[model samples]
Target: MNSAANAHLINSESYVQKPFTLPNGIVIKNRLLKSAMSEALGTIDNVPTMKLATLYRRWAKGGVGLCVTGNVMIDARAIGEPGNVVLENDKHMSKLKLWAKAGTCNNTQLWMQINHPGKQVPKGLNKNSVAPSAIGFGPALTKFFEIPRELTENEILDIITRFATTASLAKEAGFTGVQIHGAHGYLVSQFLSPNHNQRTDQWGGSLENRMRFVREVYRSIREKVGEDFPIGIKLNSADFQKGGFTEEESIEVIKTLTDDGMALIEISGGTYESPVMALGSNIKESTYTREAYFLKFADTIRQETTASGLKIPLAVTGGFRTTTGMADALAHDNLDMVGIARPLAVDPDYPHKVLSGQAKTNPIRAISTGIKFVDDAALMEVAWYTRQLHRMGVGKNPKPNEGAISSLVKTLLTSGYKTFRTRRLRA
Candidate 1:
C-alpha cells in the first residue's frame, strides 16, 4: 500500500483521542487501554491490598480508557509469582471494592485479567504443577519452573468452574469487566500450543479441541456476568516457537470467539521462554520503525477476517512509544486501541500526554550494564519495571532513571526473598 493509499485507507487523525465501543455495547472513553502488568502487591493471603488501590488510582487518573489489572490467578494454589493476587472466593470483597473504586473513578473500566499459571508455576511454589499434558519447560527454563503433570479429567472440569467463579466475584466486587488471560503461555495459552497440549480427548489434540478450554472458559464467564458485562481476551499472534501455536491457528481461535460475541481482543505474543512480549528479541530494522511489534501479524489478521466479513475490536500491545505510531494504527483501522504497558509504568499520564499533544517521544531506557550476560537476563526487565510499580503503590514517583543493576538488586532484596519464603501457592 502506497503512503497515499495508506493515508486514504484509514486517515491517521480520525481516532486521536477517539472513544471506542466494544461489540457488547461498552463504550470506552478513549482508545488507550492499560494493558495488564503483574503488580505483585497482594497480601500473604493473596488478597488485594490498599497499595493496589493506590497504584490503580494513579493509572485511573492517568487517562487510560480501560485499565486491566495484573494477572489475578483463579486458583490460589497455582501462581506465576510470589505476590500474585488470587480471587478464588468472595472473602476479599472489601479490598476488591476499594481497588475497584480507585480504578473506576472518572469512568475508567478496570478489567481483572484472570488466569491459571499451569506449568509456568515456579519450582517450590506449588507441590505439583499441572497442564494439558505432562511437559517440562525445556532445558533453558527447567531450572526455574517445575515439570508439570497432566491434569486429570476431573481436574480440568474444576478449573473451568474456577474461572467462572472468579469472574462472578469480580463483578460482585464492582469491576466493570473481566479479561481471560489466554496469552503469554498461561494455562489457556498452554492448551492452545500443540506441542504442549497432546491429549486426544475433547480438550486437546486437534485445534478445535485445543481451543475448547478457552471457549468453555469464555462461555462460563459469560453465563456468570450475563450478556451486558464486557469480556475481553489477550491472545498471542503466535507463540513464536517451532511447532507451537501458529498465527493461522490464532486467527481461527479469534474468529470462533468473535462469532460468539466476544467484546474485545487484544493481541500480544511470546511467553516467559521466548519473552518477546517484553520486547526482547532479534528485530528487523523495519520492525523498529513501527510502533507495535505485533502489527505485521495484526495486518495479516485484518486481511483474513475482513475477507470473511468480520470486524472485531482489536488492541495491539508492545513496543508502542510514540503518538505517530498509535495514530497511524488507529487511523488505518488496523487496531481499535493501543495497549501500552512499560510506557505507562514510568509515566502514568502517557495517554493524557498523547491525547493532549505534550508527549513528543517517550524514550524506552535500555536496561543494561554493557555486559552481554547481565544485559541479556530476562528477570532484569521484570525486576526493574516491578520496582517502579511498587513505588507507585506506596505513593512514590517511579524512579525511571534508576540504574538497571540497582533496580534488580533492590527487587531481589525486597520481593525476591519474600517470594521464596511464601508458600502462598494453592494446594
Candidate 2:
C-alpha cells in the first residue's frame, strides 16, 4: 500500500459496516460483498467436496455481508471449466446443504451463482458447444474456443428449465439467495449481445428478442423460488467490443429487470475476447483515480433509475483497491454495496480488517508472467489467484507473492489433463 494513497483513506466503519435490506426483505449485515470467484474446487465427478465447505466457512467468518459462490454449472454435459459443481438434482443434496450451512455462518448471506458457458467452453472440453448462433470467436480467441452450433428452440427451452431447476434445488439446500451469472461473456451474456446472437427467430435480431432468454430464465426461477427469495444478476455494463452489448442496452436491460422485480444488479464488463473485466486495460486515467473502473457507468444508471422511481441496489466489482475508494463510492449514495473479489482470495478476513479500521489500503498488486501474450490474455492472474483459493481450501494461508509463471504453467497442465478426462467420459 502506498503511503500517499493511505493519506486519502477514510474510516470505513460507518459506511462499509452498515446493514442493507433487499427489496424482498432479506437483510445483509454489512455492505461488503464477497463477489464470486471461479474456485475450481470440485471432485472429478463435479461434486461439491468438503473443501468448499471449509473454504467458504473461512469467508463467512471473515465478516462479509454476502458471499456469492463460484459458478455452478446447470448441466453436467456443458461445463465451462474442469471442476465446476453441477447442481441438477438431489443426488448431491447432502453435500450442497453442508456447503450452504458452512458458508451461511456468522449470519452471512450465501448466494449461489448459476451459469451455462455456451460457446465459451474451451475447445474439446465439452462434446460440442451451443449458443444462440453458430458463431466462433475473433482471430485471437479462435485458437482456444471452438465455433458453436446454433441452439434449437427446444434446446433453448430446456436450458431455461435447467436454470429454474438449479435455483429451486439451491433454495431447498438452504442457500440465502441466487444470482444469474449474466456477465463475462457466458451463455446469458452471449444471448444479450448482438455480436454473439445473430439469430432471426423470436430469440434474436432486436434487443428485446435477444434479452428474451434472460427474461424467461428469470421468470422461471422466480416462479420456482417464490417472491420472498432474492434473485439477482451479475450483468456487464458494456462488452467493450464493437457492436457488442453497449451501456445504453445494458441500462434498458436493467430497467426491464427492475420492473420485473429483480433484487440486485451487480455491474461488471468485458468478455474473453476483450478480457477487460479484470485487467482494466481500456479504462481512462481519471477513472483509475476513482479506483473503480466502471464507476462512470454505474453512476449514470443510478441517476437513470432514480429518476424513474426505481431503487435497485447496485454493486460494481473491479479495480477497487483501497478503503478510500470503497468509502467514497458509498458516500456518493449511488452504490449500495462494495463488491470485492481478488482481495478476498489473498486475505479472507479483508472485510473484517476494513470494517474494523485496521487496514487503509488493500494488498493487491498487478499479476503478470512477463510474457506479453499470456499477460494480455489475463490467464496468469486467474491462475495465480486460483492457486491462492486452493491453498485456502486445504487450510493453508494464501501466498500473495507466488510466482505467476509457475502458477500459469501448473494450471495449464492440470486443465489439459481434466479436459482429456472429460472427453474420455463423454466418449
Candidate 3:
C-alpha cells in the first residue's frame, strides 16, 4: 500500500474476499461486485423472464458480493435496448419476484439499475426521444437515433416521479437495493453532460443545473427506499470526449452523492461516441497498465472521500481483468470494491476462480468482426456476448473461442434476431 496516494492501506487480508459494509448499514458479503451489463433478457412486453432468473441464479451461486442487474426502464416506452425489463407498474410483480428470488439467492445482494434512455433510444424503436435539449447524437450515431425534443418541466418532474415509483417497486420485489443508472449516456447522464444538455431551465445550463436531474433522481429514490436500504450509482469519471463531462465535474457529483448518503459509487467512463467504457482510450495510461479503467480518477476520488471523512464506498470497473491489479488498487485504497462485467459474462464463476487462485490470468478480450459494418456498429460486441449469456442461461458452458463474425451472422439470421425484432417491431 502506498501512503503518498492514500493515508491508509487496505488490510493484508485479500480485500476482494472480505465483507464490505456500506454507510447505510447494508453489508456486502464480499468485495467482488458484479457490475451492471445490459442483459437483454426480458420479454417483448417488458416482463422479466425465467431465462433472466436462471442466469442470475448462476451468478448468485458464484459468490459475488453484489450483482447489479441491467438497465430496468422506469417507463416501458423509453427503453435503452431490446428486451430490457420494465418496472413501470405492479402487474409484473410475479415475474419480478421470480427474477429477484433467483438473483438474491445465497445471500447475494441484487440491485436493479433503473434508467430512462432519453435520446439514446434506438431509431426504429422510438418516434421522438426526449432530452434536456433538442440535441441528437453526433453524425456517427445520427442514423441510429432520432433527434430528441427538449423535455418540458412537467415531463421532467414526471420522469423523476417514475424513478421513485420504480425504486419503490424494486424494494417491494425481492431486490435488496436499487442503483440509479446515471451514466453511459442514459437520460440522467445526458442531463449531466453540458454537451448534450444545453437547456436554459433549472435542469440545465450551469454545472449545478446540469447535475440537477441526477440529484433529484437520487433524492426521489432515497425518499422511497429510506435510510437502511442501499442506494448506489454507476457514474463516469469523464465523458472522455471533447467538451464533454469532465473529471472535475464528476468529482463534484461524487461529493454530492456522498453527502446524500449514497451507499456506493461505481466509476466508469465514456458514452456511445467515446465508448471508452468498452474499448478504452490512450488518454489514461493507468486504465490499461493498471487494469482499472477509472483508477486514475478513482485515486482522486479516494483522496476526496478520505479528506472529507465520507464513508461512501467507491468502486472502479471496466478494465479489471487480473487479481494482481485488483489487489494493488484495493491495497492503496484507490477503490473499495472491484467491478468486473465482461469477464463474468463468459465465466460466471470468475470471481471464485480469482479468489481461489484457480485462474492465473484474465481471459476477457475485445470482440471483433472481420467486416467493417458489424465491427463499427459495436452491436457485434453485444451480440457476441449475448451468445455466451444465452448459453449460461440455458445451463450450458460458454464457448469463449466462438468466432465473433459467426456469432453476429447467427444472431441476425436466427432466434436472437427474431427476439430482437419482436421487441422492436412492437415499438
Candidate 4:
C-alpha cells in the first residue's frame, strides 16, 4: 500500500520478485514484463496521444518491471491497423516523450516495439502492401488481403533505414529500449517464412538469406541507438504453418542474434494465418496444463543457449496465466522474465498481486462471440481486449467480464469506419 511496504514486497525472495540485470547493465526490478498488445490508442494521423500516456502510466504504477508498447509502425504507408502510431520522424516528439515518461514511471523499463505490417494490412487500410516476394495469402485470407508487390532492393534498403530511424527517434523520446517486432507474421516474420518469401535474390532462398533482413535491421538499430541502449526482439519458435519458419531455423536465428549482441530474446509462436500464439494449438499437452504453451520449446532453447555460451536474456510470451506457473518457470530457469499480455489488460495491477502472493491464478479466459464465424476469426479476442485497452485509455477500469458478442459487433463497426476514413484520406 505504502511506498516502503510495496518496496519490501517487491524485494521478496520469490523468483518472480527478484530483480535481474540485462547484459546491457540495465536492471529490471522484477521478472514481470507486460508483453506487447495492440492498444490502437493513437490519433487518426498516426501520432502518439495523451491517452497512451494515461494507459501506460496506469500499468507503470500497477507494477510491471518492463512494459513493451504495441507495434509502432516504422512506415506510415504500411500500417497494420488504423490507430497504430507511426514514428517516422520527430514531428510528434513532444507527445512521444510524454508517453515514454509516463510508461517508464515507478522505475519501469518501457520499450517501444517497432514494426512494419507488410502484407498483413487489412484490405483498404493501405493503398498497397509490400513483402519480400510477390505472393498472395491462401484462400481464407486472400479475400481480406491482396497479393503484395515484391519489394525492390532499394525499397528494402529504405525499410532497413526506417527501422534505424524509428529506433533512434524512440531513444531520443526517452524510451528505455526498443524491441524489433520480428514475430507475429509482420514484415520481419514474412521475410523469414519460406512459404511467404519465394524470392531468389540475396535476401531470400536460403535460411541465411531469409534472415538477412532481420540481422540488418538489428544492426542498423544498434548502430543508431549505441551500445548502452537495450535492443531486444520477439521471435517465433516456429510459425506453425507448413513450409513456414521452422524451429530449427528459429534457433539458428537466435544464435546469430546472440552472436551479434542482442540484449534480450523473447520467444513466441504463430502468425496471423495460423494464429496459434494464444490458443496453444499443436503444443505439447503437458506444457498446456502448466499454463506456458511454449515452455517446452523455451527450455530447449535455454539448454541450447547455455551450451553455446550465449548470455542473452531470454523470455517467452503466450499462455502464461498463473503466478505459480510464472514463478515455477523462472525457478526452473526456463526464462529470465515472464511475459504477460492480455491478463494485464483486465487487471493492471496483476504483477503486484502476483508478487505479494495475493493472486495465484490469472483471471483471463477464452473469449467467444458465440457466433461461429465471429468466434472463428482470431480478431474477436484481440478486439475484446482492445476494447478494454480503450477503456483504460479513457481512465476507466477494464471490464473483464464484458460480453464477447457485443464487443465483436462494436469492433466490426469501428474497424469498418476506420478503414473507410483511412481510404478516404488516401484518396
Badly placed stretches (over 4 Å) of model 4 are 1-13, 280-289
Question: Over the full model, what C-alpha lDDT does candidate 2 score relative to the true structure?
Answer: 0.89
**Candidate 2 lDDT tens digits, 1-427:** 3443343354556678889999888889999889999888987778999989999999999999999999999999899988889999999999999999999999999999999999999898888999999999999889999999999999999999999999999999999999999999999999999999999999999999999999999999999999899999999999999999999999999999988988999999999888878875323447565788888888899898899898878988987777767877887775888888998999999989888887666577778777777777776688789889999999899998888888888888987898788788777
For residue 10, model 1's alpha carbon misses the true position, in angstroms, by 14
Q: What TM-score does candidate 2 get on C-alpha atoms?
A: 0.96
RMSD of 2: 3.2
In order, the Cα lDDT scores of the candidates are: 0.86, 0.89, 0.83, 0.89
Q: TM-score of every model? A: 0.95, 0.96, 0.93, 0.95
Rank the models by lDDT, top first: 2, 4, 1, 3
lDDT of 1 by residue, 1-427 (tens): 4464366224443355778888877889999999999999997667789999999999999888999999999997887888889999888799999999999998899999999999997787777799999988878899988889999989998999999999999999999999999999999999999988988889998899999999999998898889998889999999999999999999999999999878899999998888888863323447565768899888888999998899988999988877777887876678998898988889987878877866676655776755677666667787788888999999999988898777777787976676656764343
Worst-scoring 10-residue span by lDDT in model 4:
4-13
- Each model's Cα RMSD: 2.3, 3.2, 3.0, 4.3
lDDT of 3 by residue, 1-427 (tens): 3463342133322657778888876888888889998877787767888888899999998888899998899987787766778888899898889989999998999999999999998775655689989999998989878999989999999999999999999999889999898888889899999999999989988899998888898898888888788889999989988898999999999998889788899988888887877763223444366667688888887777777786558988987777767777877778888998888888998878877656576677657676666676656787788889888877888898899878878877764564467555665
Lowest lDDT block of 10, candidate 3:
4-13
lDDT of 4: 0.89
Clashing pairs in 3: none
